[model samples]
Target: MVNGTNTSGFGYDSSTHSVIAEPAVWDSYIQVHKEAGKWRNKIFPHYEDLCIIFGKDRAQGNKAKDFAQMEEDANNEEQSEQIEGGFEEQTTENEDSPNIGSKKRKKVDDVIKGITIAANLL
Candidate 1:
């Protein structure tokens, strides 16, 4: 919110002389201008160039999206690195594993006394 107003949504588009209601329309207008070879900024372009692209209401929505994507990408990269490091650390930690519960049961056989280790454990 800038100037106590959320400047992101439908706004007036004087470039085509109409109110741009959706982001898709604004993006198309920019693409059209770029294909026409006249996409540019004239010094203080806040009221001139950007107004044509986003209109009066959506001043920073596109920029905000770009920044958000950049932040997400950075986070993903960091997470990828962390996962790779985890694998490396896991291999070393497995050497001192606390898996004593999975150890094989000791062998015992005493048919006369009726004491025997179950075959299922083998």
Candidate 2:
């Protein structure tokens, strides 16, 4: 908390139950939370862990709805990352393949080849 531009001190408002922090300290807190959010996303793969990180109140807050939203956000974020960075590593320019993996591509290619041969014979 800060008082009258003084750099050092903690001030509490009894009514608000919140500390008034210096601008610099407040900014630091914001930055720390942003970084922690990144780590939380990476470390917590499940809804329970996310709730634990967010707080118990969050875990209990309309859990069916809130947890579903969290999972949706996580999935959308992962898919967006994969779309942007080409994490679908096994995918190719070919559109016929349904799966993104070497084995799947091989199977698709064989099917295409057989179809081509049948078309030529006809």
Candidate 3:
């Protein structure tokens, strides 16, 4: 019954032997692990969100896969260009236009496709 720093049965018993924990010490451990479980969820929907936004038909196209690949390729190309040229190049079609953030800028995927089409023309 002693709950202070030390005393009888709780700490030193009548024989002064330190008894270990008893069996069935915790009868309810599961409830502690589930605390705030529902509050923890992904901040952003997986690639599926992008697919829906792009209006892709699940039965026909895998847009999430395509986008992941495209983004990977664009990143690799950028790194290679930076190393070969000492720095990556930036092109602006109009100087007087308003400055926009990076995401607002035209994607390099479109630029690459345009270059591919122009190369076939020549």
Candidate 4:
């Protein structure tokens, strides 16, 4: 929005011939201007030929969104790589026999036999 003269209550004084803005209106105006300045400072980081140029293209706000997407993709790739690396480490640690637990026979076979019998009855 273009900056306009404040005219939100106080009228012009005849003696000074200058518009006398109300205190509250003036405060609000100053605050708004301050915020606009902040935004301009953030977006337009550089100056070229007295014209403010945005850090990125003003027209392509989509570029910021694309950057966010790329960041998310990078994060996902990092997580996948971490998981694959962990699996690789585990495999290397147990390369000789993958199922080391299966070599040790236990009482679980009797339990499985009982479960199978029960399942057949059902």
Candidate 5:
């Protein structure tokens, strides 16, 4: 015989000094635990793949090699754009200014020559 006030057959029991567990609460907890376990299992493989791809240095996350490759790609793209005449020639109206146009043209030519050499290397 429980000695506390019972509300709809579930309430705090003074004799047991503990709150009765509702069935729905236990069911929800179980469902959440199961879902968490399922997701962990599903994601573990991808995590392992990343570890393999990144190698032992995965923990540091430095990715220096990747960053260097990206920088090289960007430089190559910029060189290509320059070769394609992507930059506009800036002309100064002052006659006293040295031949800026010739200098700029020479710079573009040098970049073109460098890219040509690199292409020949490949």
Candidate 6:
């Protein structure tokens, strides 16, 4: 009872009386669905409404924390650069000064003593 050359299990194109492959049927279905409306056209308004209702506080808090952390990191980096520059200047000056070795040894001893005191306090 079937038409000519339509023995394939895929969709039958009645006009052409030929069997459409599964992939072709799916492609045509998707094409028709897309022509009806875009996927986002159905969901964008709901997404926007949800963001407006729920995103404000969480977004602002995260942004504030991130900005603060960035500023703190920048300040720490700047201070470290200044400290390194100061040490370089000190070494250059100390090269011309008398008792350069003694001066550096005394500074090292002072730092060690400060660390010892801090350890004792802890």
lDDT of each: 0.47, 0.51, 0.42, 0.50, 0.53, 0.54
Residue-level lDDT of model 6, residues 1-122, one tens digit each, is: 01236533344344554434555544665576766323311323254345456664655654455645765675677668657855875777667775674576578667756855775575
Sort by lDDT, top down from the best: 6, 5, 2, 4, 1, 3
Clashing pairs in 6: none
State model 4's lDDT.
0.50
Tens-place lDDT digits, model 5, residues 1-122:
11235453434434544434466644554476765333221223254345468665543456455655766887788778765653344434144345776677789779777976886576
lDDT of prediction 6:
0.54
Look at candidate 3 and give me any clashing residue pairs.
Answer: none
What's the distance in Å from true for residue 94, model 3? 30
Q: Model 5, stretches more than 4 Å misplaced?
A: 1-87, 90-98
The top-ranked prediction according to TM-score is 4
Top candidate (lDDT) = 6
Model 2, residue 59: distance off in Å is 8.6
Whole-model lDDT for model 1 versus the true structure? 0.47
What does the lDDT come to for candidate 2? 0.51
- Which pairs clash in the backbone of model 1? none
TM-score of each candidate structure, all chains considered together = 0.26, 0.23, 0.21, 0.27, 0.26, 0.26
Off by over 4 Å in 1: 1-65, 96-122
